[model samples]
Target chain A: MKLKEEIINKLQARGVELSDIAEVAYHLQKPYSKDLKLEDCLVAVKHVLEKREVQYTVLTGIALDILVEEEKVEGALAKIIREDEPLYGVDESLALAIANIYGSVGFTSFGYLDKDKMGIMKELDTTKEQVNTFLDDLVAGVASAASAKIAHQNKNKELDEAEIS
Target chain B: MKLKEEIINKLQARGVELSDIAEVAYHLQKPYSKDLKLEDCLVAVKHVLEKREVQYTVLTGIALDILVEEEKVEGALAKIIREDEPLYGVDESLALAIANIYGSVGFTSFGYLDKDKMGIMKELDTTKEQVNTFLDDLVAGVASAASAKIAHQNKNKELDEAEIS
Candidate 1:
């Protein structure tokens, strides 16, 4: 399968659908965009996923989570990751890379999703059966980037209208 | 020349030295590491420069700055970039990609350096003659990643000491 498909499959296996992430993105952009549709958010999420950096981050995080599940990771790092330790910042850092591609709005959106644990992010965070240390943040990253993309599009539309006037 | 050397040369041509970036990194880490040396920071900066993502970001940002200087970029985007508009968040977003590799500490450090605009970052930000719309944030990103590298090392050292006890 293609890398994007592979990533999607991986997320699906982890109980996260792209639509779930899109819902979060819609939530973030709704206030800013009066007529925004959920479909627009879904398209933005897919566009964000097409990025190589985002794909690599998702694969890497998922692979690590799998390793933890298999008990392959060693020592202190393993324990920290398995427990999703509050202070272990690497997971969030990896996710930040995804959001960073969009803009400052991306960062702010990510910060909010991360802290608020909205939608699928909250579900991932509360799940104890599997290690989701990185997946939770990755979900937030995608949602944040998608939201930023919609915001940028909205801004460009306004600029275009202004120029026409 | 290799990709690494090519990136270094590009920065040198743009009037930024690795040591200048190292100074910012050292400043960020000094409060935490009593024995942190400037050389250590320099080494960390070099290490960050070695990453493909960082190298690509630096080259891309510099290339755009050069394009703006040569009057190649068109329309409102060009004007926004040339003026270094405060609301143009893409520059900082690109830089955040470089910092995201390290961890959450890297994000915080990048935020601080971007805001304070110290050392070479300050010089790049204030140079009215040149379009440094992206270079300033790139500098902050490098310094932040280097600082985070040192911080991670220090944390590992503490963990080792604790385990030994």
Candidate 2:
């Protein structure tokens, strides 16, 4: 399978539906856009998944989670990751790369989702059986990037309309 | 030449010195680490440069700046970039990718430097004769990533010392 497909499959296996993430994006952007559709948010999510940085981040985060689960990760670092240690910021750091592609609005939106723990993020965070240290943040990253993409599109649309007027 | 060497050369041609960036890194990290040396900051800056994401960001940003200067970019987008419009968040977005590799602290540090516009950032921002919309943020990104790297190292060192005790 292609990298994007593989990432999608991996996310699916983790019980995260793209639609759920899209809903988060829709929630974030609906306040700013009156005519926004859920389908538009879903499209934005798909675009975020297509990015090379997002693919790499999802792959890397999932691989690390697996390593922690398999008891392959060694020593102090492993414990930190396994516990989802609050100060161990590497997971969020990786997720930020995904949001960073969208711009400042995307970056801040990721921060919001990360803190608020909305939608799939809440489920991912509360599930103690699995090491979701990275997955939760990655979901937020995708949602925020999609939201930011929509915001940029909306801005452009306004500009075009203004020009026409 | 290697991609890294080419990037360095490109940066040099644009009047950005690695040492100057390292100094920014040193200043950011010094408050947190009493024993930190400028050389250590330089080493961290070098390591940040070695990242594929950072390298790609620097290359892409510089290429866009060149495109803008050459008048190859079209229409409203060109005007936005040429003027370094405050709301043109794409440059900072690209820069954030560089800092995201380090972790949350590095990411926040990049935000700080970006807002404050210290050191070479000031030079790059104010020299209006040339287009440096992206270069300023790129430099800040490099410095912040290096600072975050040192912070991580310091944390590990503290852990080690505690274990030894």
* All candidates: DockQ: 0.13, 0.13
Query: How many Å off is the CA of B164 in candidate 2?
Result: 1.6
| Residue pairs in collision within model 2 | none
DockQ of candidate 2, scored on C-alphas against the true complex (2 decimals): 0.13
After superposition on all C-alphas, the RMSD of every candidate to the true structure, in Å, is: 7.4, 7.6
Worst 10-residue lDDT window for candidate 2 chain A reads A107-116
Q: Per-residue alpha-carbon lDDT of model 1 for A2-57, expressed as tens digits? A: 99999999999999999999999999889879999999999999999999999999
On the 0 to 100 scale, the lDDT of residue B69 in model 1 is 95
Score candidate 2 by TM-score against the native: 0.57
Give the residue spans of candidate 1 off by over 4 A: A1-87, A90-165
Across A83-127, the per-residue lDDT of candidate 2 in tens digits comes to 986458888778787876777766656755765677788998899
lDDT by residue (B32-88, candidate 2, tens digit) is 789999999889988999988899999999999999999999999999999987458
